[model samples]
Every structure is written in structure tokens, then in C-alpha cells.
Target: MSINNDDITPSKDNEIREPMYGMSINENPKERNPNSSNKLLGVFYGIGMNVNTIIGSGIVTTPGIIWNLVKSPIVVLLLWFVGGIVSMAGSLSYVELGVIHKISGGETKYLQTAYPQPRIMMSYLFSFMHIFAIRPGIISAVLQSAAQYFWYTLKEHQYDDGIDINTNGWKLPFTPFWYVKLLAIAFLLIITAYHMFNTRWAIYINQTLAVIKLITYSIIAIAGIYRLFADWPTSRTNWQNSLNGNSDITAYSASILLITFSYDGWNSLNYSLDEFRKPEKKLIFSNSISVGIVILVYLLINIAFISVVPAEAILDNDKSSYETIAVVFFYKLFGQSPVTVRIFTALVVLSVIGTAATGIWSLFGVHLLSYSLEVIRYRNKGNLKKEKNDKELNEKSDRSSKIEYEVSLFFVGIFILAGLFILIFSFMVHVECPNYNPNCSLREKRIEQMSPMLISYGFLIIALLFYLFYYCLDTLKRQREAKIIRIADK
Candidate 1:
């Protein structure tokens, strides 16, 4: 569904009249006009979304990877704590920006307001990179991870009755490579279709999943605490030797990057401020509460993992068998029971799914809608300007303008659909070989192909160049308009 420009953009009545941080929206409070069809999201959903998006697969997967990298549990926990601080700082900055702009579109709106000299170039660049590259990459990666966990869980359950179901290869007899790809695609379609049809229900489902995520983490943390107390000797030894490992500077930097990624969705609420019931009061509260919960839960969960699974074990654990630190933790705590491991793996899959759902819902509903509206507005304005000089053209301009707007929308819709299709299917098609063999030419070829990181950055570079090109054209246009005014005056 499209967002109405008038609803999202700040009206003169809603203009900033006080300090941004201390701004009040109650001075001229309009009665809440409730729309059943398009309900505004509340602060509760805001917190839910932040929590759901922020606590995705990263927390479950990265602890072991970080421990492997830094070889220091102390450094891993410190990096995580630092990451939380950075995310909180970012949330505050976004709160201020959201308050000042009082609009949706997040960075797109902020960039336009902050860099108006270049006319809408910054906003366009942000929209281009975000819509085409960043958002899609994130969604695809999350869904792919979710699919892997789901398949892993199924394979584990299959082996419950003494049947060895080999899950080492990319393609197994029971679970083919296409099965995983199709599962991921099915996840994307189901979530996308649900959000498309039922906005209110989608938010409700997100909130429910957010609660489930919190509960899942709490269970892990509590279990860890119990283990720590039950077996203080092991826990104490692990904690004491937390820093007793090789701390390579390069690995430390890389671990920090991973922690930062874990903290990514802290600013998700900024994307849909206009959908909020009362953004001014709720923005800071929602962000603060969400980040705080994630920080506490993350630290506790790490402690829980450390309590049961030592840093050496984390570093030496077979990643092929144990996909995440959580799996290792559960196995250490509950022995080698497939049922217990499958349960936690299922939780991890749910966490990943929640993150994907929130990402797609926000991107499709707010970001794309905002960008499309911006395009339509720009086209209509240019058309109005051109029609002013020719009487005959002015008469037909409305019809032509209508046609142009519809065509622009049609192309935009097609572009978004095509991008989504490519993003989902292409990532699924190129399955990374689980165990790299020198004879695996297809895996080597896949690695040689352009990486998603390079492609995303390439788009950003192109965006900057586009901004510069458009900035020059906009400056020239303004200069000509100024010259015409001066000549008319003479």
C-alpha cells in the first residue's frame, strides 16, 4: 500500500516550534482519526520491531565465530558491549533526526533535509543504494540462514531413530540443494504476501514473535545462570581464563565488525516514524527500551554460552555439525540428545524468520512507498513547470501528466519486483559448498564471481557519481532561472 504524501510529510501546523528533543506535539492536538483499514502502529510495535530485527541470527551464530577469531572470551564480550554502546548512540542520533524531520523514509528524508543544496541528489542516492542493494542483501542473507537452520533441524530429527542422515554436503538424498532454495523462497513469499494483505495482522504477528524471541533468550540466559551456579568450578575457570588466548589485532578488528552487524537493526524504527501513533514521545522511549533489552539479553546469553561451553571448545567446535554457538551451548548443557538440539535450532530458525519478516515488511511498506511517491511528485512538478508557457500544451498536460505518472509507477513496480526476484533466486541458486574440496570447480567458480559486498559498494559509488552529475545539472538549472529573472527585471 502507498503512503499518502500529506500523511507522512509534516504540515505547517506540525512544524517545529520548539527544541527538537523537547518538542511537544500536544499544543495543537488533533483528535485521533482512527482508520480501521490503515491503523497506525503504536510504541509497543515499535519496541517489538526493534527487538525482533536486532536479535536475529547474528547473536546465535557470531559468538562462536568471534571466539574463534579473537581466541578470547573477554575480548568477545567486550566487543559485544562496545557494539551495544555504539548502537545506542546511533539510536539517539536517529531519534533526534526523526524528531526534527517528523517524517518517514528514515535516512532518505534526513539526507534531503541535510543536503538540500544539491537538490534531491543525496536522497536519491540513499534510496538507490538502500532499495536496490542494502535492504535486499540483508533480507536474502537472513532468509538463506533461516533455510539452512530449518534444513539442519529437519535432518537432525530424521536421524532420531538411528538412521544416519548425512547433512555434510550441499545436496543430500532426502534434502537436495533445491529443497533449501525453495524453502527460502517459500519463506520470502509467505512473509511478503502476509504483509501485503494484512498490515495489522503482520504487526501483531511481529509483536508475538518479538515476545517469543525475548522468551527464548531469557530461557537461554536462565539456563546458563543455572549451569554456572550448579557448576561454579567450570564457569569460574572459563571466566578467569577469558583473556588467556591469542589476540590478533586483525582478528580483533574483524570481531568488532561482526558485533556491529549484530547491532544493525537498532535503528529500524526510524524507517517508519510516520506510521507511529505519537512519534515525538515514543521515539526515544521505544529505541532506548529495545536496545537496552537486546544489550542485556546478549550479554547474558554470551555468559550462558561461556558458562557451559569454554572458549577452547568454541574455537575447536566443528562448525559443520554445530552451525551456531547456541547449538554448542545446548549440546554441552543437555548432552548429545538430538531432540534437545533440534528444539534450540528450531528457535534459531524462528528468530531468523522474525528478522526477515520485519525487514521485508518495513522495506516494502515504507521505504519503497516513500521513494515511489517522491518520484511521482518530482515528475508532476516538472510537468507543471513545462505546461506554464504553452496554452495548448497546458490543456493536454493533465492527461499527459496522468499518463506519465502511471507509467512511472508501472516501471517502479516492475523494477522492485525484478530486484526482489533476482535477489531471492540468485542467492538461493549459488549454494556454498559446506566442505571445500580442491576438486570442486563449481565452488571455486562461485567464489570467483562478484561478491555481494563488492556489488553493494559499487552501487554506492555509482550513487555518489549520480549525485554529483545531478548536482551540476541542478546548479546550472538554478543559474539559468536566476539569469532569466534578472533579464525579465531589466
Candidate 2:
């Protein structure tokens, strides 16, 4: 419970009490939580994680896709409800596993705890997409998306001339050459600094930001809903057939893909397992409550979005279902001046950025914990630790762990910047608006036709394939090995 600075010294007798990073991984993690930052007020922690994990980058973007799939506002809300149920089910499944496993990998971590050795290997391999593909890709996508908004704000405010809106300088420093790079670097630095400072501060800041972001969303939701019934859309049609389609696969797939991102962070409470007050109760409690709140928030937000703007308009997404909807709603009531639109855009952007930051920090913590465990608990025969002096052991472990943390921070930074750069280069994968040209009136495009969405989605498919193939193969191999081991034990 205490810092135990005196016992944390290099003395041989003190070694067993230290954490893995302090040569304590061998010292019994049950007795020491390397990542515990704060006691985490029961409800607030769930709220913190819920706020951190939910309200992700998907919110501003997913409505159109949902509406496209299910054209009715009533159906759209219903679908989100279905999505939340599935999300909660998955979260609850992890609770049993998380309590049993007590490892830090979140989803994969739970799998590893169950299977242990060979199973863990397979889990990580399958998770290469999550680890290598989806997590990084998705996180990068958010930061980059935020970067664009920041770029947009800067462009709008920075330039003396009015916005072209279309031909924005997406560069950092706003110059033609390295403007993108500069902003990318700035984003990385911000992400790295927060994570590096300390987990306690990081989570605290995250929780605080989550609250503000939630409030902002609450207001927007209220305003959007007020406008909806205030002057409910006069025209309506029965497009249920076009929306869900008859195929169950398409319906469910459509539902899963859109909501997965929004519901991705339900496991946030699990990742910091060591930090909780009583993990068993706290974990499930936090997850359930946070997800419940998020469902409410998401449903309200969607209701607000579709309520103010018609399903047909949102489905069209000509100027971004999100922005266009916001623009129309505000214009009807508050008057969508350029400033009003900009501020609204900024709010959504902030929410997304906060989610991205929280997710990346979790990712970093996973690596940091795994590596620290390796360096401390399982000493390599080739490492020549037999000759290590007592006085230097604590110092060396701390130094190495700090380096590992720093290196992880660097890659995380690079990943964010690289993903953003790649998206920008790949024709705005990280940034897209509904093709809202005042000239062209038919706002909607076919699914395959939208370029940015198509590309990002294509990558998503590729990543999923990678996760599926690798994990399946790895799982089979591990299961075979487990059978052999059980036979041997018998």
C-alpha cells in the first residue's frame, strides 16, 4: 500500500518486496500492483473508463452508416440498443476471465490467462491485427481525425482569408511542405507526455476530460432532440426493406462493424487490473455501469442526430452525416454560422481525441508490463545475472524499465504520426466529410463508391482477415499441444 522507498533499495534482502520493474515481477504481483495509480472511486472509475472507452471516434461518423443500413430513425435507435446488449455481453464474458487471469492484455490477456503458455502465443498472434493492425490503425485513425479538425480550426482561424473548406492545408505549421508532419509530431508529443508523466495523472486527466466531453455531448444531444420534435421532419417513408436488407449476415455484420469501434473500450476497466480496489467486484461493476451510461449517451446522441436531421439526410451524408446534420440542426435553431459549425466540430473532435489518447495509453501499459515482466521474472541463462552485484540490481532494473517505457512511448508516438501521415497520403483516410458540394444535390453515394470510407474499410477488412487467419491457425496448434500436454500429465 505504501511506496516503501526504504525497502526498495538495492539491498539483497529488499529484492523480494520490489515490483517487477523493481525486480519485483518475481516478487509476487498478487502483493504488488505495478500500475495502481489511485484507489478509483467505484462509480467514477467505471465512468472514467466508460468515458475513456466509449464515446470513441466512431460516434460522429457511424450514424450515416447505420442510417444507410436501416433508414428509419426508430430502427437506428433500436439497432444501437442491440449493439449495446452485445457489447455488454462481451464485457461480462471478460469479467469472469479477467478475474481469473489477472493479467494485463485485456481481451487477449484474458485468453492467455485461460490457456497460459501455448494459448497465450496463439492469442497474441491472432491479436497481431488487434495489436499490430486494429488497435494501432484505429487509434491512429482517431488522432489523425482530430489532427484534421485541429488543422481545420487553425486553417479557419489562422488564415486571414475565408476558408476554401475543400482545399485545406492539412500540413503542420500550416505550410505546404511539412505542415502535416508538424501537426503529427505535436500530437505524438502530447500523447507521449501524458502517458510518460504517470498512469495516475494520465487516468485522472482522462477522467476529467471524459466528464467534460460527456457534458458537451449531452448538450448537443439535447439540442438535437429539441430541434427534432420542435419541428419534426414533415416527410417520412417506409424504407425498412432497404435499410436492414433481408440477409441476416449483412444485417449483423453491418451492426457489428459500426458499433464495435464505439463499444471497443468496454474492457478499459480490465486493462488496469492491478489498479482497482477490489478487482472482482469493481471490474464487472465498473464495466456494466459505464457501458450502461454509454448506451444511454450513444442512444441519446443518435436520437438527437436523427431527430433534428431526417434519416434520408443522415443516410445521404453529402457533407458528412455528422457535420451536415449538426449544420442543419444548428442552422434551423441557432443559425449555423461558420463559427457555430466550427465549434460543434471542435466538440466532436475533442471527444474523439480523448478516446484515442486513453486507448493508446492502455496499449502502452500492456507493452510496458509485458516487457517489465520479461526483464525481471524470467531471467535468461545467457544474461549472466549470476554475477550481478546487489547494489546495482535495483538501479539497473529501474534504468532498463524506464528505457523500455520511453521506447514504447516513442513507437506509440511514431505510430500515431505514421498512421496519420499514411491516411493523409492515402487520400484522406484519416479525414473525410460527406461530399457536401453545394453544386451537386444528390447527397448519398453507394457503399462501394465513397472513396475514403471504402479505403479505410478495405484496410479494416484486410486487418480482420489477418486476425482471423493467424488466430485460427495459432489456436488450433495450441489446442493440439494442450491435448498432448494433458495426456503427458495423465
Candidate 3:
């Protein structure tokens, strides 16, 4: 007997009678589009991105600052440990959110999902802060830090000419002020161009740098361990009274804040979920593993610092003279050799560059602006069905073009603004402190006056007020619509 195709319905158990090639029986074929781009990332890339983002110049700089503030090795280690725990918790939360959404734009998506009553108000606020302040600020800070390291390396060589009198090397002819700003701008352009073209290659380079970062920190930790064993009595003395120091609450609070900032990029992977091949399945593993590795490396590095450098020396090291804690740590370990200084400086510069590059990739990956536009379009169309119609495809193309333009414009604007600020600050410093004295109170005051935190908080306040106003208007509009419907029905 011949059976009609219409009569072939699903069985009571709902078993699949046919499966497509390269697909599991339970998998949905529609989820895997054969015509899409083949540049999707996997679990390892996600881990690399997160690790690169999380381990920036902070790890090399903050430990000494924290130790100076709290004046206790135990408190410094505790703060770092607690910061890691807090960051891990936050990462796990983001993993759950990313899995459910299975999209990019990170906190913007979460805010929109959680608060839909105000009609995109929450997401708008977050996007405003992120695009305007947070993203650019992070990129600028990392690039500037890298420039500072480069300048410090030059300064070290210039002053230690006696040690390297026979060695000939190239050097810049500008002052530190001009040198740093120009170098930072140069780094920004190069990194921007690197990511703008050949995204797959950029990801590979970032992953390689992440691995190098891991190896560098591991070597430092191993050296510290060897030092601890080499002189057990001295190292034991360093840890004997770890808790014997001032307990000023204000300083302790500040140290905690610094540590928390060091752990800022734990949610880096969430920003690129759409790029991942199987985000839902790999999100938890990627985030957990990355955060776990960071936590372990951070603790070990801190222990190593304490083992090699005494707390008194760390606290007493003149901030004006030393570049960073990592500098002091290496100098203590390998002596004041110019070669050792240059080697560690290069490593730190590489770390900063890796961080800035990954940050650029995450921020400019078309996820943020495209997601916003998609949300707006979806609201206007009202649950439209997806079809491969000409008009629909055209609209998608237009949107793609719009997103590309906006992303380019925004990227350029950020760098321009950063450059302007650097120039303005440099001019002011030159005019006010002609001698470039490190102890100039006016320089410190000028920096404090231009604090980004205050500006960010001001934006936050404005956003909150705007949200309340929008919520009230939305509620009233809903009530009016309901009344009109009731009257028509009656």
C-alpha cells in the first residue's frame, strides 16, 4: 500500500524519523546555517579573550599601591583573594545571563530583559554610559599605561649611561609629555587598524599574547618560590608578622576598591556571545576556567612578591622614583642591571598591549550598536515572521551599513577626544609646572579635578532621573490605551 506524505505525522513519542547530515537527531537543523560566515570562535578563544582582558596593567601596578595603603602583607593578600571571589561570582552570573540570551551586548541585553516596562530606558542608559565613557576610558587608560612603560624604559637607559656606555641604542628626542601622548596615539591607531581588518587574525594574535602572559607570570611565580626556598630564614621573617600594621579603615577600603578594579574585565566574554560557536554550552566552562586561572595566578604572584620583597621596602619605595611594583620586584630579584630592566619593561608593555587590543575587539565587534538597532526594529515591526523576501533582505543590508558607519564614527571620535584631552593636560602641566616636579601639588590637584569617577557619577544621576520620567509617561500611556479599548468594547 502507498502512503501519502500528508499522513506522515509525528509519533506519540515525538521521535525524529529523519536527520540531516552533520546534525544529531535531537538537534535543530535551523540553528546551524550553512551560508553564514565561517569565522565563529570556540571555547578556547573565549577563555583567551577573558584572560587577556582580566590581566591588564593592574596586576603589575596595584599590588604595590595596595601594600602601601594598607601597610600589611596579610591585608593585601586577603584583598586580592576577596576580589577574585567577587569577580568569580559576577562571572558566573554573567554566564547564566549569556546562556539565556545567547546574544551579545552583555549588560545592555540583561538590563533590557530585566526591565521592559520603560520601553528601552534601562538599556539606553547603560549603552550611553558604556559607549560614551566606560569603553573609551578603558582603551585610553591601557594605551596610556603602555606608553608610560615605553617612556620609562627610555628614561632608565638615558640615566644609566655609565652602566651601558658601550652599548648604542635608538632613543626619542622629545620630552616625556610629548613622547607619551604621541606614542599613545600611535598605539591606538595601530591597534584599531589591526582589529578593523582581518578579525580572525586579530583573535589569534590576542590568544597567543594571552598564552605569553600566562607563561610570564608563571616564570615570575617560580622565581619567587625558588627565592623563598633559597633563603628560608629571611623569607620566613617576611611573613612572620604579616598582620602587624596599621588598620585604618579608610586605607583598607581604598585598597579593596583598587583590587576590585583590577578584577574589572571578568565579564569580557559576555560581550561577544554571538561570535562563539556554542555559547550556551561553553559559556560556563569558559568563564569559570578563566576566572579560576586568574585567581590562582593572582594569589601566587602576590605570594611571590611578598617572598622576595620585604613589606618595608615596598612601602618605602619612593613612588616618584619607581615606575611600578613590578619594577621594584624585578630590580630586587635581578639587581639594577639595565638588561633586566629592559626585559621586564618589555613584558609589561606586551601585557598592556594585549589588554588594549582585546578591549578594542570586544567594544567594536558590531554587537553593541547592532543589538540596539535590532531591538528598535523588532519593536517597530511587532513580532514579524522571518522570511527571505527582497524587502526584508534590503532592510537588513541597510542596517548593516548603518551599523558599520556608526561603529567607525564612534571609534574615531573616542580616539580624537582622548588625544585632545592628552594635549590639553600636557599644556596645562607645561604651563603650571615648568620644572615637571613630581611633588608639585598643583599637578596632583589638577589630576584630582579631572577625575573620571565624578563625571561618571554625574551621568549616572542624570540617567536615573530620565528613567523615572520615562517610566511615568509609559505608565500613563498604557492606562489611556486600556481605557480607550474598554470604551470601544462597551
All-Cα superposition RMSD per candidate: 11.9, 12.7, 13.3
Task: Pick the winner on lDDT between candidates 2 and 3.
Answer: 3
Candidate 1 regions with alpha-carbon error over 4 angstroms:
1-33, 36-38, 157-182, 242-245, 310-313, 321-323, 365-369, 372-450, 461-490
Candidate with best TM-score:
1
Model 3 error, position 199 (Å): 1.6
Reference-based lDDT, each prediction: 0.66, 0.57, 0.65
When 1 and 3 are scored with lDDT, the better candidate is: 1
lDDT of 1: 0.66
TM-score of each: 0.71, 0.63, 0.69
Mind sharing the TM-score for model 1?
0.71
Clashes of each: 0, 12, 0
> How well does candidate 2 score on lDDT at residue 36?
41
Write the residue-wise lDDT of candidate 1 on 1-490 in tens digits: 1222212222121121121212132222233333622566677778877888899877876777777667656777888987787677667667766665555677877776566554566677878788878887888877877787787688853221232222333434443555777888999998888888988798788777777777788889999999999999878877777544465554565566667677878878877765677665778788889898899989988888877885655644333332356766777877768898888878878878888888886675346544554544443332333223233333433432321111134434543553354444443322233253445465544544436656877999988887788678866986887689799999
Give lDDT tens digits, candidate 2, residues 352-401: 67888787877764675545534553343123343344434555445433
